[model samples]
Structures are given as structure tokens and as C-alpha cells.
Target: MDWPAVAAAAAAGLAPTTPIAVTLANRVIACSAAARAAGVRRGLRRREAQARCPEVHVVTADPARDARHFETVIAAVDALIPRAEVLRPGLLVLAVRGAARYFGSEQAAAERLVDAVAAAGAECQVGIADQLPTAVFAARAGRIVEPGADALFLSNLSIRQLSTEPSLAPPSRENLADLLWRMGIRKIGQFAELPRSDVASRFGADGVAAHRFACGEPGRGPSGRDPDGELDAVMNCDPPIDRVDAAAFAGRSLASTLHRSLEAAGVGCTRLAIHAITANGQELERVWRCAEPLTEDATADRVRWQLDGWLNRRNAQDRPDGPITVLRLRPVEVVSAEALQLPLWGGIGEEDRLRARRALVRVQGLLGPDAVRVPVLSGGRGPAERITFAALGDELVPQANPDQPWPGRLPEPSPTVLLDDPVELFDADGNPVRVTTRGLFSTDPFRLDAPGRSGRLSWWAGPWPVDERWWDPALKSGRTARVQVLLGPDPAQALLLCYRQRRWYLEGAYE
Candidate 1:
């Protein structure tokens, strides 16, 4: 492939003069003669490129966009060779048997595929062999071996190409080549000739694999179907979109792509990763994991939530230098889509809970994140004891056991309403009475008033006093006697009042 040329063109920000390709890492996946002649070399960083060749410009790597572009190139190649698998961002592997028959020869088919990709906006080098890995190696090395020449073709190349892992050799590829040269085994043929037992004992499995590759021994076949298959989509803009609306639009496109991919796989995802590339080449990545596996609409909602969360975090710190230009959405975990069974009477409670959760999320998004809360009961014995508003997501560790009974505590199905602060009142006889904040009566007497009656206290209900938590000062002051008032026209309209710290007040209504 014209990897060197492509690297040069990409680094220099120039149109390709000839067929060349580059990998995602910006390495020379292929290059043209003109680019190589311009002193452009493979594996040079974009910044290092300027020192080597002043006129060369650099383009940041855009894997998703590049993959999309490569799809067009692959379509063109498919016209010439029906069965082609895209092996990497810039590499292809094809079953050449059919193509060779259609084109009268394997070389002809290879040439046609190369030309087709080049015409489709890529500079490509093509290689055909009995195996995919070997073909990839030959293509990277800019060689197109004749059929049955696989052994001869690989026998002269360096062994570094045999393995995909970069750290197989401690000494590096160049050092390994140097070591082989010193051993008088400069070519793959000589390396392969080294006794297999000796190679295995000396360099371990990697060396054995390399030697086998040089000997043209086919390696293991393709892996079985990917469990977490590739499912991602991206949106690219000509001028690099920075507007929130533009990014949101791109998000919608990506969501649609994810939906299609998941539908094709017959699965749904619970987690997703979002990536945003700014115009200045900075990348922002965020992950969203849902409490429940998400529906399609919920997935989009999460995308928006994630975007807003990231933006707020970034803004709170400091705005980035540039506007984000590209947006990518990728689902990380997938499970088989199962039919959701509904109860015959319908899950109205669950539906209501979901609506409430959505409302809470919106409120939290608008206000600070801690603004929304759910009520939780505490161990103390006052209005605060009965309930506390805790921030959402906080642990709801029950302070008291549901099964074990507290001797003096109110029974299950506690009062629905609790007044934060109690109100004070005087009896019609003008006698001072005492009540605990829990509405229990103290030693001081409290007279109850009839319902709908303005002034007179009719009768008192409780001297059912409670002296609790005397050991703790905070609790001692809070826990006091409370009395139930049969106020107004009916005892059924009785109000629960409390006397605390030597004062009487209405604490709660007994509905």
C-alpha cells in the first residue's frame, strides 16, 4: 500500500499525488512515490514531520470518519472482488478465488481492486495470498506475490510482521533484526531453519510462531463471532461544528446508527461511551451506565444527559480552547433483546415511578444536582426523627428494623403529614400545658378544643408521656412529651400537638 505517501500527504495536509494510505495511528499504512521523495517517512509524529519536511501539513486522526470514507472505497473494491473483509482502518483482506476467476488472473484482480480503491479516494496497495495475515504483511511491505509464492515472499521479510503484538521482543524489531543478522540468519528462511525446539526453548511461543509464519505454515483460523461486536457511528462536519444544537443533531444521527446496529444484532445496550473531538484536536470522552437497561428513547435521553454533564463539568473547570467538531456514540455492553412482559392489570406503579424519576432528573438538571430528594426516617424522636429529606441516590439504610418492634414507637402506617416546626396554643382556661415534639403529653396538662370552635379547650387526650434518648444531649432536647388534641367539632379532627423545651405547639395533623 502507499502508506508512506499517505502519511506524508496527511501530515502535510496535501492531496495525495498517487495512491497512498495511512493507519489510524497516522502511521504510513501506504504511500506514493512523490510523498516518499519529499522526505516523508512512515511512523513520524505529526510534529516531527514539520522538522523533516517544512511544507508538509498535518491532519489529526479521525478513525470514525476515516472508516466511513473507507466504506466507499470498500464498496468500489467489492465491485471488483465480491468477498472483501476490511481488516483495519486502512487494510482489506479478500477471498481472491472468485475474483481471480472473474478477472482471468489473480494479479489482474488485485490490480483492479487497488485501482478501484484509489479511484474511490484512497491510495492502496494490494496483496493476495493463501492466508489473511500473510496477505496483510505483504500489502504492508508493498509486495504482491504470485500465487504459491507465499513461502518465498515471506522468507525474506523481517519476522516482526508475523505477530500483531508490538512487545513480542524485548529488544525491539530493529534490534531483533540486528541480532538475527549477527547470527547469520538475516532472512525469514534462515530464521525458520533454526531448530524448532531450540527456537521454542530460546525465544518462547512468539519465536515459534514467527518461524512458522516464515515457513508458510498457516496460523489459526479466524476467531468465532465477536461477543461484543462493533457497533458505533459518528458525525463529521465540514467546518467543525461547535454549536450545541449542531452537536445534538449529530448525537441524534449517532443514536440512529446505534439503534440500527443494536437492532441488527438483536440486542440492546445498558452502557454507552460518547466521544467528542474539538476543532483544536482535544478529545472528551464520557461514559453513561444506566440503573436499568435503556429503551431507544432512554438511550437518546442518556446521550443528552451525558453531553450536558460533560459540558457542565468542562465549563465549571474552564472552557476548552475550541468547539467540538465530531461526535461519536458507541454502545459498550449488549444483551439479547427480550420481550417485556406486562401484567394483565398493567404496571401502573412502575410507570408512575418512571415518570417520577424522569421528573426528578429534569429538576436536578435544572437546579443543582443535589436539589431533589426522597424522605427517609431517622432514629431520633422528633419531627426530624420521623423523616429526613435525603439527596437522591443516597443510601437508604433503614435506621430501625421493620420486623423488630420498638416498644413505644408509632405503629406501622405512620402519619402522612409532619410539620417541620410546631405551633403554640393556650387552653381556654388559660392554663399552660406541655407536650413532646412527638405529640406526647408532658406532666403539664393540655386541654383539647372542639373542632370548628375558635377558643375553648374541651378535653385533653394524652399524658402518654415518653422520656427517650436521655443519654444524648441532642436527642434529649428534641425528644419530649406530645399530646393528641381533640380540637374543633369532632375528636376525629384531633390535632397532634407537642410540648418541647418547656413550650407547647402543634407538630402534626392526625389525618
Candidate 2:
């Protein structure tokens, strides 16, 4: 919550003293201390927040921005304790036993951890308990309980804490706590004293978990699954792989190794992790999830696609600095192959998908990744803007969500052809046709003049004018006026022309 407001203010170059609020869906989700002082609070409507704090600076809540800026905080904690599990942007949990032992005491470790984060420019509180849930609550209260006192410290707390405390458990358990409250078990002590068998019989596994937490049992916290007995495929790229083809070639064998291992274990993966490390020590990881368990070819294809995306970034600056030095494929989630029931119909079988994958891989190898791209229809005002490109095996996500209303965006019957470059429009006298700031045509277009073709204009429609981001000069793309015109001596060809920066250019063509 604090991270969102701090990130927003930081982006706007506002000091920590500034009254700021971050809103999502027009409701205030996070507010700075100054904003709170001014009466702006969470859950308030944007207008209400502004009404309460007239000087408040409101920003749209961007989870991406929050996470990006919160990396500093994570880095700070990780410096002392590697691999801390981040529960949320601001909440992190880990077993600090080793750190405490090294520092000679838990409180000293907590103090140093707090100081480390403070040095990183964010204030943090630390808590230590025998169990995770109690430690989470203790952290919230900004206290460190002595060892073996987890139950005693939590006994008097309201039962709602189980539901409200984020690190303790999920909200489903909160519903159980609410039900317990209705039954007059209003404190953790009461819930802890309930018979484990009775709780399991009445409320089930979630209730049992809740009971464990309330009893201060060292419940399973995400220490990551037992890796000692786990099978993972790892390969070192000795000379390093800088090209997509090489990476794809290497990924195939590695995927085969992983599948063979899984096959021997009689299981198949539904969710798999692709982990790569650059020669420069930069780590890249992505998770691929499938409806059905992944086969050998399916796993290889996913790895290849992921490698292609990493290597074939359109923007050169976004590309990795060096070749990948290592690659790993780990099955994070799996189920027995026999447990999966194939659909009766209407789905492509594994063999068919594998064949399609091989065909795409061949095309990607023969032609470079960029040369073979899949077109995805995206939301945009113009025909040229609506089409986006992704690498052959890459996933396609819209440039902008089509569901959102885009004012002033052009309606379609989209044009059949989009010109690579705009063409000039001229009058019958061969004088340049122009558009005024008021959207009026200086002279009617009577002829179309492009590099290889010229023709007399037969008819035309529209001088549709659009002004985008006029309020912010930095983002403004300049004003543009468009027209649809037919030009030819015999059979006229219809064209879309746009006038901008004192020149007319061909935008698209109709069939």
C-alpha cells in the first residue's frame, strides 16, 4: 500500500512530504501520510479523496510501477538473506534463523535487517516467532516475540486476525474465522483449544490449517518444495548461445532430458519453469502453463518460443547484454500422467500440435525470427496501428485492450492494404493539396502521385481530423487529417491519405 503511493510520488518527482494518493478504478487504494493527514483515505472515491484533500495529487495505480520500484527493497533484504519469498509487493517472509544465529541474536538480526532496508531508502519492520502466521502478525504490530512464546503472544488477539493478516493465510481461511466468530470463538486461544479432529470433521483442511496457525504450529511456509529429491534438467552452454537458432537447438535436448526424467518418475508437468542465465550473470525466468500435461515436444517448443522472444526483441536496446551461459528447465507443478483425462473431441491432439510446432520451428530457422512474425489484431485508431507483430512462436497480447472505449478512434471496414509510406496528393494543376488547421482542404485532390504510380482523382470523402495528447506536448503525435479518395484514368483505385506536418501521405488502400 505504501509502495504504490511512494512510487507514484517518486515518478512525479514529489518529495516524501507531498500529499499523494494512488487510485484504481477511480477508488483510492493507497495514500501517503500527508494525504492521510489531509483526510484522504483508502476505499474512498477519487472525487471524495480530492474533496477531503484538495491539494492531493492523484495518480493511477500501476502494479507494474509498484513492483519495479519495490525491487530496491527486495534487493536490500536479499543482501542479508538470499531468496526471501515475497508475499506481496511490500510483504516478504523467510526463515531468518540462520541470519539471527549469525548475528548472535534475533533482535540484533531484526535491527540490522531494518537498518539495511532503511539504507535502501524504505523503512521496514521485522518480526520473529516460532511460526510464520504469528510472525506476520507480530511484524504488523512491529514487535519481536521471544522463542516459544508464539502461542502466548497470539492467544489474546482477535480471531479476525487470521482472516486479516496477509502472511498468515489466504482469505478462504478468513471465512472460516468469521464462521468461528459467529460460533463465539472470538479469540485465537479459543480456536487453538478446539479439538483438531473436531475442526477437521466440521470445517475441513482449511480449518485445520487455521487451527494449526492459531496454535503456533510451525506450519508449512513456502520454503519452496523439497529440492533434494526433485528432478530438474540443467545444461551449461560452454561457448554461450547468442542466436535464437542455437538456443532453440540446445533447448530441444534439454527438454528431452527433462521429459525423460519425468517419464521415469511416471509424471508429466502441467506448469514448467524456463530459467536462463546470461554470461554476464543476469537471470531470466518464465513459467509456461498448459491445460493438459506437457509432452517432450511441447516442452521443447515452449522453451524455443521463450528463447526466441528473449533473443529477438525488436528494440535493440531491450536485448540482453550477452549470450546465455546456462539454461535450466524445472517442472514446478506436475501430476501423474494417468490422472489426466483426454477430451472426447474439439481439441488438437499432442501429435498434431507437435507437427505444427516442427513446421513453425523450421520456418523460424530458415528465415530469421523477425522475418517470420504472426500478426495480432490490436486496438488502435488506424489500420496500420491495429496490426501488431510477434515472433513465430511468441504469444500475442493486445497493444491496448479492445474492451476499453477509445474516443476518436476510427471505425472500420478496415482497409485491405496499408502503405509502407505515405504518398503525396496533388490537384489537377499539379499543385500540392493541403489541409488547414481548421480541417479545410486548401485545394481539392484531383490527382494521386506516388513513386511508381500517378493518376487523376475521380472522387473523395472526408477530411477527418484527429488531435491526440494535445494536453501534453511531450506525448503529442501532432495533428493529422485523413481522406478517402479514388484515383485512376480507367478503373480508379481507392486510397486513404493522411495530411500531417504540411505533407499528404498514403495511409491505406481499399479493395
Candidate 3:
């Protein structure tokens, strides 16, 4: 999450001390320290955050953007520690036993690791505890507990810590903690002090497991499974393929090979890294995380996604100067296949989702990336401004923060068909019905003539005034007013019309 702040700071040439918030789905997901100081916090609505910090830079939370910037930090940590589990783009955890032993003490190891991350242009906190959860909480507080003090350090923590402390907490643990809190068990110590057998009988296996963590008992970490060794599939580009189709073809084969090998070994990866090297030595890499164990098609889809994100640039400047020379898929974190629980009932089954994804990939290959775009909600008063298209495989971030109060947005029952070319609107005299400079209608819209039908207006809704970006010269599209009108008498059809530049046009249809 900090990566978003870090990325925004770097991109905008602003100091890391500047207040910033990365918004996703119209809520604050991550905020910089300066923003937090200004009363901005996680989960706050965007408008509330803006009210608190008017100068705060609001950015869209793009996981790909975060991961792309985070790769340097990973490389830096890997230089110090051979392998570290990247729990997410920003959060990472690695066993410090070896590093501490080599450095002669845990404190010394933590300092060196922190300094390493600092050198990579990121501020990081390192903490050491016998257990992973305790270590993570300690790291957030910038503290390290003594080797045997893990349980003691966690005992006094509030039950709410179960939800907030960890990057990802099991839903069961969160629910159990809430239940315990209602029963007056507010601290971790209280829960831990309960008889283990009783807790198990009351809350089942998840409760017992939470109890163990609460007592500072060492739980199995990522190292428990031990990495299966360089289980990555690599594809070499002999002539340096530039077209997305060719690169995707190679990715499909490599993805198949990688997944087949993992399935044969009876394990599956939860997080996989897609690494690519351009002909000019520019390194492009991304990590794709999955909720369920990745199947062959799932793996291939990710490969295509990462590839599309890199190769399909919206502008010339965004595109790499050289073609990709090498592409690699490395399993960064693996889980037992049995750990994934397949849902029995849902909207669409896994097979259907996979098929849909494959179809999207095929379209991207055939029509180019920009042709198959996905809509991301953004802040704007106008219909067109409210949604921006993101290229397929691009980590979708809003173009505008949706939580902002758009003064003149169209009301509910949005138009379904947005016309590419607006049909001209006219009056009974065949003269264009115009909007005046004072935001008033010059004449009533009496007749409607278009491609398919010609009829008198049956009914009409008011011309809602909309004036956007009136000051910014580059974006000033001038003032316009919209009206929802019923075109025909029998089972009247709805049409959204806009008036600007002394002319009226059909903008969309409610059908």
C-alpha cells in the first residue's frame, strides 16, 4: 500500500513527505504519513479525505504500478537475503534466522536489511519474532521482540488487532475475535488463557489456531513447505518479437509448461512473477496473485495479462523502444493444491471464468490491446467523464476519484446505448433547438428526426445544466445542458439529448 504513495511521489516529482492518498473503488486504501496527519485514513470515503486534506494528491491504486515500482525493493532484499516471500507488492516477510546468524545478532541483521531497502529508495521497517504474525505487527511498530518474548509481546494486544495487524487475515479469525469481544474477551491474552480444548470445541480448528498465535506459539511459516527450486518457465525471443500476438503465443506455451511441472509435483503457486527483459536491457516484471491455486489456463491468462500490460501502451512514449527479448514466469509463493476450497455454487464457475478470460485474450491478440478496454469508474459530472477505458491487462485504476461529489451528474436509470455519432435534434420547423448563453432553452424540442424514426416529442425531462472544467483551457469543453425526452407516443422510447454550440444532438438511449 505504501508503494502507491511511493510511486505517486516518484512520478509527480514530489517529496515523500507530501500528503497523498491512493483510492480504489472510491475509498481510501492507502495514505501517506502526511495525509494521515491531515486526518486522512484507510477506508474513508474520498470526499471526506479531500475535505480533511485539500492539498492531498489523490491517486488510483494500481497493483501493477505498485509491483513495477516494488521490483527494485525485492531485488535489494534478495541481494541481502537469498529468498524472501513477497506477501504483496509492499509487504514482505523472510526468515531472519540465517541473516541474523550471519550478522552475529538479530539487531545487526535488521539494521543492515533496513539500510539495504533505504538504498533502493524506499523506507522499510524490519522486525524479528519467532512467529510470522508477531514479526509483522512488530515490524509495523518498528520494534523487535526478544527471541522468547513473542507471546508476551502479543498478549496485551486488543482483539481488533486480529483484523488490522496482518496484511491478510482469515475471515473466520476476524468473526471469532468479534464474537469473543462481545463476550467481554477484549484482549489477546484473555483468549489465549482460555483452555485450548474448550476454545477448540467452541470455535473449531480456526479458533485453536488463533489461540496458538495469541500465545506466541510458533506457527508454520512459508518456509515450512520449502521452495521446490527454480520452478519458472522461460521463453527466449530470438528475433525479438514486438507484436502482442507472437509474444502471447510464446507465453501460452511457457505457462503450460510451468503449470504442468507444478501439478506433476503435487503443488501449486499462489503468487507468480512474470519477468521480461527488453532488447535494450530494460527489465519489466510483475507479480500476479491468485485466490485459488492457478490452473494451466489460469497461468497462461496471467502471462498474457502481464504481457499485454507491458506491450500494449496507449501512447508512443509509454511503449518500450525495443521489443521483448526474454520472458520468464517464476512461482514466487506456492501452496498445497488441497488448501484451495472450490466453491460449489456461484454466478459463474471457474471453467466459465477461464473461458471468458481466454476469449478476452484472443480479442486482445486480434484487435490490439486498446480495442478491448475495460471501464473504470472515475469522478465526473458528465456520463463520458464518469468512466474511463483501461487497456486490457492494465491494473485498472480510476481516472478520477469517484467519491467526489459531481454536481450535475445524470440521475439513476443511466442510458444503456451511448451513441458513437449523435443524431441531430430539430424543431417542427426543421430548425435546430438551441441552448442560450444564459443556460436557457431557446425553443422547445417539438420534433425528433433521426436514422430510424421521425415523430413529435411525447414527454420531456428538464435540461440539467452542466458546466465542466470552465477554467482549465486544455479541458474546457464549454457549457452544455441535457434533457431526457420520450420520442414516440405508443410505448414511448427514452432519449437523452444534449444542447451545445447552438445545436442539439441525441447523446444516448435508455433502451
> Candidate 3's error at 493, in angstroms?
3.7
Which residue window of length 10 is worst by lDDT in model 1?
A: 163-172
Q: Lowest summed lDDT over 10 consecutive residues: which window, candidate 3?
A: 220-229
Predicted structure 3, TM vs. truth: 0.77
Write the candidate numbers in order of decreasing TM-score: 3, 2, 1
- State each model's CA lDDT, in order: 0.56, 0.75, 0.76
Residue 21 of candidate 3: its Cα lDDT? 95
Model 1 per-residue lDDT tens digits across residues 1-511: 4433443454455666533333233344333565467666666544345555566544434333333344455556656654344343355565677678888987788788778877765667776677555676777666767767778887777544443322122223445555566677757777877889998897665566566767777753222222243777677766676554444444644665687677777777655666778788987654444323456555655455445434433123333457777778777655566632236776458658656766665575457446887877554444446555655533343343233334455434444576635455654455555554555443444344324333434555564455776777766454556565565454345566666677655666667
The estimated TM-scores of all candidates read 0.40, 0.55, 0.77
Q: What is the lDDT of candidate 3?
A: 0.76
Q: Model 3: runs farther than 4 Å from truth?
A: 44-55, 165-167, 170-186, 191-212, 224-226, 229-268, 271-338, 346-352, 376-386, 400-409, 423-432, 435-441, 466-479, 489-492
- lDDT string, candidate 3, 1-511, tens digits: 4668887777677898999998887799899999999999998988799999999999877665665556567667777976566566677777788888999988999999989999878899887888888988888778989878988888888987876633446655668878999999989888889999999999887787788889998765644232334687888988797876677667876776797678667778877778888899987655555434676766666676456556654345656668999888888778876765546674357558756766776777678767788898887766776788987655566777787677888887778887634566667677877777777667777878777755789888778877876877776456778888997777688988877655667778888
The TM-score of candidate 1 is 0.40
Alpha-carbon RMSD to native, per candidate? 21.0, 9.2, 5.5
